[model samples]
Target: MRGIVLNATLAAVKFAGGVFGNTYALIADGAESLIDILSSLLVWAGFRVAARPPDANHPFGHGKAEPLAALAVAVFIFAIAGWIAWSAIREILTPHQGPHWATLPLLAGVVAVKLWFSRRMTRASEEAGSTGLQVEALHHYSDAITSAAAFVGIGIAVWGGPGYETADDWAALLACAVILFNGVLMFNRALADVMDTAVSPEFESEVRTVALGVPGVAALDKCRVRKSGLSHLVDIQVRVDGELSVRAGHDIAHAVKDALLASAPHAISDVSVHIEPIK
Candidate 1:
């Protein structure tokens, strides 16, 4: 919620500054920030749905909705980038007088705020295990860099003395490129999550170590893991001693689950263990 509010405020400021200053780069940057606001809102909405208890229709809970929201954000980013690029091309073809000199200070302020927001949100998202929030943080970080580029362009346009106004168009063009690149990156990441990619190797290794450590477990046969939003849904198969009783196998499985939960509290959402007698 805090993230959402911050993004919304930044978006409004950028939009207003961009329009009044008659700076294409600033306007593009502002548009990207607006996209961030939408992304943050989508993330918050997804989390809200995810928190709902499992019902008859969605036995697995609504966690997957978070990734879907991320996908939507990616699409929105792509559309915004496309629009910005089109406008930039038009401006370049029909050269225009530069933006207001005052926009430089405003852009600098925006850059600073974006940098701080990115760092803080990144840490918070990582700790909370919210991949969506992390992606949004990255977006803000990228915005800062692009906005800085715009600042340089604006500086050149106003003070370069001769033929520097061309720099303004170049800067807007560069900003458009950055926005497109970010949109592609976001799309790829969100698509991977929607496809249920395997969890990180570090996470898999931790799960294996815990499962193998369970008493009476002879060895690990298989471990399959998938992400559901910020959490992992693990399916593991372990080989236990053939002589072990049913109760012993159950206890061992429970131990493995508990150990995994303790080891990676933020990552492990649920664990399902299959016990097979050692051959």
Candidate 2:
């Protein structure tokens, strides 16, 4: 919600400031900020859907929505980058006065706000266990960087004599490259989520430790994991004495499920346990 409001305000500010002050960089950044509002809304909608309980159609819940939202954000970024590059190239070829001195403070404020937003996104990503939020954090950081570049471009044009008029255009071009690079990296991560990427070794080790802690279990045959929204779906196979009856093995499997769901820090939404008898 905060991000929505802030992005909208900054978008309007940068767009108006860009036109009034003749700074191509500020205009580009502002345009990107406007699309950021749409991205934020998409993320909000995705999370609302993801929070829904599992249904017949989506037995694993709607966790994939977050990744899809991230993909949309990446596409938006790519579009913004392309537009900025084109706009900047035109401004450079035609030539124009840089941003106004009056707009410097405003641009600085935008950078500060974006840096704060970047930090906030980082915390939110960690708490929610969301790769989407991680991508957003990076996006916000890029905004700060670009905004700073705009500020410098304007400052140099104002005081560094007449030939520096093209500085703002150059800054916009650089920002475009940075935005595209960030977008590509995020695209890959979101695609991985869509593919149901596996969990880390440390998490798998934790699952094994918990499962092996069971008294009747002789060994842990295997453990696997995959992301499901903010949680993971885990699979475990446990070995036990061959003499144990089928009923006993079944009980052990149930025990393993209960233990994992209760103890896992990553919030195991579903767990499948296979009992293997040791010969």
For model 1, name the residue pairs that clash.
none
Output the lDDT of residue 149, model 1. Answer: 85
Which tens-of-lDDT digit does each residue in 1-279 have in candidate 2?
A: 888899999999999998898787888888889888898888777777866779999988888888898899899889888888898889889856556787799998999999999999999988998878878887888788889888887888878768989887787788778888999998988888889777788888889999998878999877888887677889889999989899999999999999999996556888999999886
Best model per lDDT? 2
lDDT of 1 by residue, 147-265 (tens): 88889988988888456665766776777677678767777777777788877898788889888887777899899998877778899999988898999889998998888888888
CA shift of 61, model 1, Å: 2.3
User: Worst ten-residue run, lDDT, model 2?
Assistant: 94-103
Off by over 4 Å in 1: none
- What are the models' TM-scores? 0.91, 0.96
Q: Give the residue spans of candidate 2 off by over 4 A.
A: none
